[model samples]
Each structure stands twice: as structure tokens, then as C-alpha cells.
Target: MSDAPVRTLLLWCPDWPVLAAEIVDGVPATGPVAVLHANRVVACSERARAEGVRRGLRKREAQGRCPQLTVVDYDPGRDARAFEPVVAAVEELVAGVEVVRPGACALTARGPSRYFGGEEAAAERIVEHVAQACVVESQVGIADGVFAAGLAARTGRIVPPGETPEFLAGLPVEALGRPALADLLRRLGVRSLGDFAALPAGDVLARFGFDGALAHRLAAGRDHRPLAVRQPPADLTVTAEYDEPIDRVDAAAFAARALAEQLHDRLAGHGLACTRLGIEAVTAHGQELHRVWRHDGLLTAAAIADRVRWQLDGWLTGSSRRGGGGPARPTSGIIRLRLVPDGVIAQAGLQAGLWGETGEERERAHRALSRVQGILGPEAVLTAVLGGGRSPADEVRLVPWGDERLPARPGPPPLPVARDTTAAGGGEVADGRAAGRRRGGGSASSGAAGAGRGGAAPPWPGRLPPPAPAVVLPSPLAATVHDADGEPVVVSARLAVSAAPARLTVGTAPPTEIVGWTGPWPVDERWWAPAEARRRARFQVSLADGAALLLAVEAGRWLVEAIYD
Candidate 1:
């Protein structure tokens, strides 16, 4: 909406995670390496990429692509800590350096460009300073706004004044970084920034909401939002010293949760929320480990604890994975751990809803979950989230109860799956709704125990339609499906059914009459991998007793994979 776009400069360090690990662990830069999060590749070195490794590939797949690749779990704190020196170096040249994230930062270009003679010169100076300060590679870009600057930085470009829009017109819509929105645009034939920016602003707002409008502004080479940079307060650090060294992750995490709560309470008293945190630890042998973590928004108590846990997991386990023989285990144990609030912002007070539960109830739930985490470990207490996937299992993502839940990846909507009350082992049958009442007593207990456990995998293209089975067995149960003539039923590779199913026998249960049946829905999984290829046909049948079952035929054998009660 402004007559003149804000002049912004961005500095980005590619593969910062892998580089940070290399810096911290003394790993050579030439070797193929990747940084993983949730067992998926988040970043990889140029060497690794050249070897066919890519972001989002599973760890095994990445390794399969680059057999000698070094894998490291992503540690935001570590990346941030390692980048502080780079930020300090840049600040020496520019007065205000706002870190966009751990690996990137942005600053107003007007002052620096004039001082350094030109925008291109300023960029060169920043890159030189960072490289000399940390021995890491960095790229710089100058454009009309932060969004364009960030994309330009990826290509190390400098857009002349008033040319930002024209410069960005040809780039892919993905430059906006909103995957779902970008995917939608692509499907609508708006594949480039020019295509997107050409649409009516009101129409974009009416259809895509706030996020889409913001992306549209970015594509048009306009600033999406204003920046509010704040200086972190000194002396806002909390530390814990152990009388007896704590060597295990569980113990360290428990201590982290307590400290995190204290830190949050302290910040709340000052009406502040931390946006960036620095975690430091001292091992018994006197080895010091430090890392910084940055968040786009305020960090909650649980989020802080989760970062602490991740940092410890990386430091404690990372040593063993360092090349040239594992670094000697931390001589003794961790003697001290400290958390520093590196960046803070004022947060508006949260008003309780008139009809909704009060803040006290939320706090109580938080405390209960924290206690469980302390007892059973962080992964044991999880919250379920629906994400992009075809099957119920693929759609369900379970993150630690206290941690942030990210948006699901962009993809087609999942087919509706029927909810089975007895799926976990209790629910009504068609003939008698009360049939599961007696079994319902233990259902809650069983469900609680499996709260974070995921459901069926991503929907296989030819998988069964929703109204998914109430219960999916961990392992298929052996069964037999026969035709009315008492002969075994068969489905050919071409998917022709030999005969209609008439009888079903599961495990040691007596054969039951099939009242109805549907499907020979076939799936050919991993057909390209000879060793792992699977060809199967599935059928859903209703038994005379009002029980429903999902049966699969693989290699001429019938197996009961799920039941609907």
C-alpha cells in the first residue's frame, strides 16, 4: 500500500545446519552430509545434493542415494548459536541486523548502500565479513522488500531500484514459500509470480484469506509486513547446577522442563516472551556446549523445553556419530545447564473466553502432561495432529504434547475414514449396539496408552475407501475366504475375481457366512523395487453375526487386516 517499497537486503547461508554441525564437530566440508529432522532430510550439503540427496527424503532414502553421507539431526539452538558470530560480524557493518531465521537475516539497505557506495558493494562487504568471521559461505541480495530480497539472495542478485516487480515476475510461485497456496496457484495455471500478481487483489483476498493476500503482495514485489526489531535483555538467564552429574537424556529433559517453567514465569512477570533462546551446557569433564534457537513467534514454556531436549539429544548423541572414531564420551556427565533469553517481545495478556474453560484449567493440563513427560520421557506424551496424507495413519502426526505443531505438507485432501468406537477394542455392532458395552470399560485405558501411536499409513492409491475399519491389526491375522461352492477364491494379477466370497474363517474362529461383500481393490506397492514389491487385493465383507472385516489376499493367502465392530 505504500507508494515506495522498502529497500531490504538479505544474507543467506545455504545448508547452514550441515555447516553448523561441521563447525561444531570438526567434520570436513567436502564430504556429503545432510541434516535431518523427524527422520527426514531438512538440509544437505552441495556434495550430498550432487549425489542425489534432497530435502524431505527419508533418512534411509537419503543414505541410499549418497551411501557415504553423514547424517545429523537438526538442532535449531546449535544453528543459532553458531550463527551469532556471523550476525555480530554483519552488525559491525550495518547498524540493524534482523535475523530472519537461524540461517538468514535482513536489514534496511538504504543506509548501508550509500555508506558502502552501492548496494552491490554492500552485499559483497557483508559476504566477505561473514566468510572471514566464520569460514562459512553466504549469499546476499538487495531488492524492494524482504520477500524479494530473500529470493534474490538465493541467486545472489541485486535488483535495481524500481525493478523489483519486473525482476520477480518470472520466478516460480514457490518463491512465496507458502506451499499450499503455491500449489493451489499452480493448479489454477498461475505458475509464476507474474501470473499471481496479475489477479485482482480483492479476489485473492476473498478466496485465499490473509496468508494468500500477503503472498500476493510479496509476488507483486511489495512488503508483506513491517518489521519490529527488539533488543534482548541481559541477565535473563536461568541455570541449574547438579550435585551429581546427570548423564542420561531423561534426567536432563526433566531438569529442562522445570527450568523452562521457571524461565517462562519470570518472563511473564515482566510481560515478556522470548523469541530467541540460547542453551548452554557444561559436561563433567568441562566441555562446554552452546546453541541458539530462534522462533518466528513467541516461544511457549513447552516449546522451550522441547528445544532443550532436542539440543541435549543432539549434543549427547552427536558425539558418537562424529567421523574418525567417535569422540570420547563426555568424560563424566553434564554438570550444569543454562538457558538465556536471547530475544524477547511484549505479549498481550490473554483474556479467557466467557463460555470456554479458564486459564487455570489449561495450566492444570500443562502440569499434568509435564509430569507424565518427566516420568515416561518426552515422546511418550504426544498430541495427535491431522496432516496431508491419503490414509488415516498417514494423515495423523503426533508431536510431543508440549511442542509446536507445524502445518501439514500440501497435498490432496484425505478421504473420509469411518470412526470405529471399538477400533481400539470397543464399539457397537450393527445387530446389537450393546454388544461392546462390557468391553468398553477398558477402551479408555487402551486408547490412552496408544494416544500418540499413528494410524494406518498414507492412503495407497488403490486402498479401501473410508469408513475405515474400527480396528486395524498390527499384524494381519491368517484367514480363508471361500466361494459358495466351498472352493478357495482367487484374484488374478489383472484383478479378475474368481468367485464371490461366501464364507470367511479367521484364525481359529469357526467359518461364518458372508452376508455381503465388496472390493477386490488391488494395490501394487513398490513395484520398482524387486525385493520389496507387493501385489495385493483387498475385500470388505459383512458377516452373518453383524461383524465387518477387511480382508487382503497376498500371494494366494487370505489375511484379515482389520475389523469393523
Candidate 2:
């Protein structure tokens, strides 16, 4: 029930993204290197930083500043793979190790401080152990809370007991990691954590929402350890045993993907995602090897699989650990693979979006689209919505992205009962000459009802029936529909057809024979306005090549409106 952050020790590897690039990709760690993501600098090596390249700089600007910079794309998998060895190394020296992210980890300091004689001694031992065991350099800090400890680790500082607030007070609001909130705080003259923390807690929650309130608590040194508060499900472990041992890296990767997917499926069934993963492998000689991988975000299936592959690659190749304190290399091929979730949480903040994509994926899309809008104009990006109209183009209206998706017209008008278009010997005619989603279809399954106007949806008159086309062209392509007598088929003002369509020619393509035909379903809209008025007859025709098309004839000109799959 305690609301205080436990006395914690944190280990941080500076510029771990760059270091990971080095460990996993063979990029030189001591060079002027920078990791670029979304055309922005995610992290820079010390040398690159010294060369005027910093995080968040545009990739182009960073290159301009450091001409010789080695650019690398940011890969979360590579970072986790490289850091897994470090987490395993730390666990050997301390219990209750929590991987805050790929590059940093934390553990309660009370026991370790006492066991090692003091807090500073425990920090020293952890730093030394990691360096010796994994050949990775890290800094350590001891503080009353994980939040403060993480900040302290940047400078290898130790905040005395009960003095965390003072230590965090002078830090900038940007340290909260909410860029927009920090910007607003700075504009409102709350530039530092101390000033932001002085606001009323209730007001912070009401204005900034839940995440902001959590940041406020961290600013006031009330950091709560999340991993310590709950127990993950124990039955989530997934394992795979192969008849043949996996000695090759490719074989190990193949096995890893299967186990990773199984593990993810089990966690998904519980509506949970893992933050910390335990991977255990058994060799033919009965020797067991295990490693832990952690991330700040939920580990996706691909990430879990990548870590498993990296760990197995290390074991089979005798690169288990650099120093003597790590696990010995396996003496034979791996016979069994196991994945255990050490830290699991509800899959909140990452729910699926409208398109069945994760929130993170949607966010990335939004950011990219927003960036494009910023460069071009907002109207450059548009989304389509279905509306009430007789024609496919009229039923769809394009609106600027992010705007309310309201249809331009009202709900469709009363529709006629659908009729089968299949005619015997009519040459493979469409089974049904209907319109979009079963004309007057029950509200869409995704948006269901109320997708039209707010209230009792308006009606679309002369609307076509169901069985929508697979593709609707933005602009109707010019085409010719003819009868067997080699005469052009035409629809008169009285809604009469001169002949049944027997051939169709689209664009510059040669005319193809039409086997079946339906509809002269006529529509006369906007008759009051001469310029906007439209009088057209629509048809569904099947061709000899086994293709179906939606055709419309207006003013003696035939147009291909859409095609059915």
C-alpha cells in the first residue's frame, strides 16, 4: 500500500542504441555514429554528440553537422539482443532485477547495500560485474525511487535518503518524457520539475489526464514500482521440442519464431503483453542455458523471436558471455526451446485501431501523415466516406484527414427489392446487379448504424441494389458498350435502351464480347441546375474473358464505372 518509490539501484548504459548497433551490427562504437528513425536522430554516439549532432536533429541536419557520421537505422530488436547479456549478467549479482528498458535495469538496494557493506559498494559491484561479464560499460546510481534513480544514473550520482525531491527539482520539465506537456509547461512558466510539481495534484489530473498526473507524481518524488505490485501469470510459458537438434543459426531462428508466436498467442488470450521475457534452451548434453530480455514497450512477437535467435546464436557459437562469470557455451545442439514471461501487464494504451492495427502502429501512421501535411497542405491528405447517392463516385466523398467523417448527402432513399441478374444463355452475367454493400445494407459491421447523418439517417433516391463492386474508379474511364448488330447501345431520355449490350471496350483495349447484361437503371439528379444535372443509365455486364464491370451511359457516351473481382 505504500505510495513511495522503493530505495532502488539503477544501471544505465550511455548511448546504448549506438552500442547495440556496434554489438549486433559490427558498427564501431567509438565512431561518430547516429541512429536515425523517422528522418530524425534517435540517439548519437559520444563522438557524434561532440560533433554537434544531438538527438531529435533532422537526419539531414545531423549529417550536415557531422559529415563523416555513420548513419544507422534504429532497431529495437538489435538493442534488446545486445542488452540481453547485460541483464543476465546483472541478475547473477543481484536479485529482483527489473529491466527498465534494453539499456538500463533496476533492483531494490536495501538487500544489496547491506550484503555488499554499503549502497556505493553495491553500485560499484554491479558496474564491475556487468563490465566483466558482458564487456559492456555502465553507470550506477542509488536513490529512493526508480524515476530519480534513472536520472541519477546519467551522472553516476547517489541521492541521499529523503532528498530525492531536491535532486529532481532543478531538472527540466522535459525529463518527464511528454514532449507536448513539457512544451505547454514551459510556455506557462513551469520550466522545471519543481515548478510543475507545485501545482495542485487534482488540477494536474483534470487538465493533463492520467499520464500527466503520473509525471507529476514522479516530479514530486512519489515514484511507485509497478513490477513489485503484481504477480504475472505462471502458466504462460511456451515451449517447443524438436526431433533434430538446432545447431545452425537459421534452424534456431525457425524454432524461435514458432515458440515466439505461441507465447504471444497465449498472452493475447489473456489480454496481456510481456515486458520481461525469460528464454531457456536445453542442449543435447543436458546443459541448460537461459537469458532474460526486456523492453520499455510491450515485446511484440518479432522482438521476442529476435532475442531468442540472438541468445541461441551466442550459445551455439560459444559466445555465451565474454567473461568467466557468465554461462558456459553449450557443448551440443539445442534440443528444446522455452519462453517464459517474467513481467506481464494488461494490453492497455495499445488496443487495436479502426483498421485492426495496434495503437503504436496507428500513432506512427498518424505522425507520418501529420508530417506530410505539415510539409504540404492539410488538404493534400484525404479520407473517403460512403454517402447517399445513386452512383459510386457520388456515394463517396473525400474529406481532409482528421476531419469529422460525415457524408455530404443524407441517408439513402427507399430502395427497390434486389432481383437476380442471372439470365440463361446471357453469357455468364453477374449473379446480381446490385450496388454497394447490399444496397441499404444493415449498418456496416465496423461502423454499424449512425454512419450517415446524426439522427434518423436521410435517404438516397434511385440508389442501386447490393453486391458492390470490388473497385470503383475515381474518374469513370471512357468506354463503349455495343449490341451484337455492331450498333452502339444507347439510353434515351425516356429511359429506354436501343439494344442489349453484347460487347465492351475499355480505354484503348480492343472490344471484348459481353455474355450477359443488366440494368438501364436510370438516375436524373440536380435537374434544377443545368451545369450539375446528370442523367445516366447504369449496367452490369459480364465479358468473355470472365471479367465483370459496372457501366454507365450518359449523353450517348458509355463509361466504365467500376470492376468486380
Candidate 3:
């Protein structure tokens, strides 16, 4: 709310997730690697990027594109813990360092700029300091506000005083960091920050609400909120003293969850959310460990607990050597754990619906899923998402339940509904068939068929029409399609069936009479790869039991690929 914009400098480390994982897990930096959250790429190394891997791609797609790519599960706590040393190094050069997240931090530029001769010099000094201390590549940028400064850091530019608006104007609206809003703006012909900034403020507020107004202010190079920095109340810290020394990661995790909930409850009572947290632990040997985590957005209870666990893992399992060697396990067990709410912001109260059900069920479901994740591993509970692909199997993606669900990309042309072979011209199949096909391809019962690798790439010219099967076999079941005389039925290269109107036998089952059958649809997949090439013809056959089956012929053999239940 201050009339004068605050001059801020932001330092950013590129590919922080990959860097953190490599540092903690000893992964080779030169190797192709990616960090995935909810089965979508969150970050990838340069080698992986060169191989066509990018953020937002599903895990299977990334692997398919780069066979050598190593995948690491996303751990925000690891990212934050790894980044702590970098923040400390920067703090040594400049005071009031405000971490934006694991990979980035911002601070008021006035003091550092004056001391180092200029904004650019201060930035260079901080970057150099971080590189020396953490051995990670970093960039620095200075602008009128945190939003503009963060954007500037991405390009390592310094915006002159009062010129932040002009600098922001040319950038794409995506700089706002709100994907949905940016996408909607692009569709509305508001392609750049300038275009968005030109919209009437009231209209933006009416259309997009509080989040939109915040983005609008940022796009215009104005601070969304006043730069009022306040210290968290001393009593807000949550501490747990263990009677028995706890050395294992699981034990620390158990303690972290309870403490995180306690901290969350206290903050909620005051209508507040933590933006920055400090984690502290004391070992039985009297050695102390401390780390700070910052978030650009509010931190929920789960997020706080995750950070605590990560910090404890680093402290307990990390190497004792401070001279840039491999991490060593701790010498003693942790005796105490504490969480400090270093920074907090007002959280608006939720408005209840007329029925008073305002998201209670969702919260309960989230808690239940979190509990399940705790009981099992993070990957045990998953949620399926739809994404771009040709086959019903390819279009579905699975991510851990509590993680952010990657937005589904545009898939191949919609599939055709299954119709009875008796119906004239094949009426559209039931909607349930489409949903079933999507779910069935990867459901638990289907085994690895729905494991995210069966989808055909887009623009598949010879793809079969949908009314996709309700149940897809993970692997085709060998079967025999026989003509009336009991001779084998074959499909020609021209896709003509040598003989139809026959009997079907699956895996030694009794022969069943075929009622009606459709044309064999030919598919030539991966023709470019000789060893992996597949040329097949598929048919939809109606049987005597009032069931439909999808049959595929490959290498002169018939197989049962799926069934319509």
C-alpha cells in the first residue's frame, strides 16, 4: 500500500530441484535427470532438456523421450534444505534477505546497492558469494517490486528506477505465475503484461476476484500488498522434547507431523498462515541444526511437516564434513525438534455455502489421503489425471493423491462410441464406455497395462475408432479366430478379413459362436523402429453371450486385446 515502490533484488538458482537432489543423493550432474511431482516433470537437468524432456511432461513420456533420464521424486524440503546454505551466503553480503522459495530470494536493494557501488555490482557480489559458498549457478536482478524483480532475475537484468512497468509491459502474461489466468488472458487477446494492465481494474476484479487483482497489480509493476515486514510472535514456536533419542527418519517424521499440526492450529486461531518457517533440531551430543524455508505462497500443515522431515533427514543423515565432501550420517540421535513461524500473513476466512458444507468433505479427504501416505509411502496413494495421447491408455496420467495435479493436455481426436455391429452405421457407443476405457487402461485390476506407457503418440493416422473396450488386457491373450470350416481366419495387408462369420476360442476355452463382426482396422505403429515396429489389424466381434470383444491380428496370429463388459 506504500505509494513508492520498493526496490528489490532477487537471486535465482536454475534447476534447483535437480541440484538439490544431486547434492543430497549424490546423482551425477552430467547425467540426464528430472524431478517429478505427481508424475509430471517439475524440473529437469540440461541434458534431459536437450533430450526433449521439459517441466509438465508426464513421467512415462519423459522416459520414453530420454531413455537414460534418471527420475527423482520431488521433495520441497530437500530443495529448501539445500538452498539454506545459499541463503546464508547471501545474508553474509546483505541483510534483510527474504527467501521467495527454495531456488530464489529477494531483499531490499537500497543498502546493498549503495554499499557495493550499484545494483548490478551488489547482484554480482551476491551471485559470486553464493557460487563460492554453494558451488551452484545463480542469477540476480533488481526491479521496483518483488514480482518484477523475480521476473528480472530470470533474465539477469537490472531495471532502472521507475521503469519496472515499462520493462514488465513487453513480457508475456505468464510472468504472473497464475497459469489459469494467463491462459484465459491469452484467449481473450491479452497476450502481454501491457495488455493485461490496460484492462479496467474493476472488470478484472469482477471477473477474476482477489487473485486476479493481485496479479493485475503485479503486472502493472505495483506491489500487491504493502511491504510491511513484521516479526512472528515469540510464542508461536512449537517444540517437542523426546524422552528417547530418535535417530531414524521415520521417528523424526512422526514427531514432525504432530508438531506441524500444532503449529497450524495455533496460526489458524489467529487467522494467519506461515510464509516462512524455521526448523531447529538438537542432537543428543549437543550439536544443533537449524534451517529456514520460505514459500512465495502460504504453507499448509502438510507442507510444513514435509520441510521438517527433510531438514531432519539432512541433519541426521548428512555428512559431518563442512569442506564440500559427501554427507555422513549423524553421530547422535535427535533429542529435540522445534518449528518457528518466521513469517506469517493474514489468511482470509472461508465463506460457508448455503448448506454449510463449505469444503469440509474435501479437507477430510485430504487428511485421510495424507494419513494413507504416511502409512504407506508417498507413491502408494495416487490420483489419475487425463493428458495428451492417442490411445485411451496414453491419455490417462497418475500422480500422488496430495500433490498438485498436472493439467491435462489436449489429447488426440475424441474416440468414437462403441455401437452394436447390428446397429446401422454404428451408432455412438455409451458414454460409460469412454470413461471405462480411460479408467480401465490403468486401473489396479489391469496390472501394468495402465502403467502410463501404452498410449499412442498424437497424430496417429491409423488409430482405431473408440467405443474403447471397458477392459483392456495388460498383455494380449493368444486366441484363435476360425472360419465356418474350422480353418484359421487371416487378415491381409490390405486389411481385408480372409474369412469372418465364424467361431472364437480363447486360451483353450470352449469355442463360442460369433454373432456379428466388423471390418479389421489396420494400425502401423512405430514403423520407424524396425525392431519395435508393429503392424496389426483390429476387429470388434459380437458373440453369442451378448458380449463384445476387441480382437487384434499380428504376425498372422489372433489375440484378445480387450473386452466390453
Write down the TM-score of every candidate: 0.52, 0.51, 0.47
lDDT of 2 by residue, 435-462 (tens): 2221122212223211232346654445
- Runs of candidate 1 with Cα error greater than 4 angstroms are 1-85, 92-94, 98-133, 136-237, 240-262, 269-281, 287-334, 340-412, 416-459
Report lDDT (CA) for all predictions. 0.74, 0.77, 0.75
* lDDT of candidate model 2 versus the reference: 0.77
The best candidate by lDDT is 2
Model 3 misplaced stretches (Cα beyond 4 Å): 1-243, 246-261, 267-413, 416-464, 483-487, 508-510, 527-531
Query: Which of 2 and 3 is ahead in TM-score?
Result: 2
User: Tens digits of per-residue lDDT for model 1 on 1-565?
Assistant: 5746788999999988988887777666678999999999999988999999999899999999999999888999999888887887887788777888988988999899899999888999989988898887999988888888998899999988899999999999988877789889999999999999999999999999988988888888888565444353345789999998878889878988998998998998888889778888898888987766655446789878987876676566545644424334456788899999988878764433673534556655655665444334457677766555323345567887656676364333344433223332222234431121111112121321112234453323453455555766778899998888999988776667777678898888999987666655565656789999877666667678878887778899999877876
lDDT for model 3: 0.75
**What is the descending lDDT order?**
2, 3, 1
Q: Model 3, residue 168: what's the lDDT?
A: 96
TM-score of 1: 0.52
lDDT head-to-head 1 vs 3, winner: 3
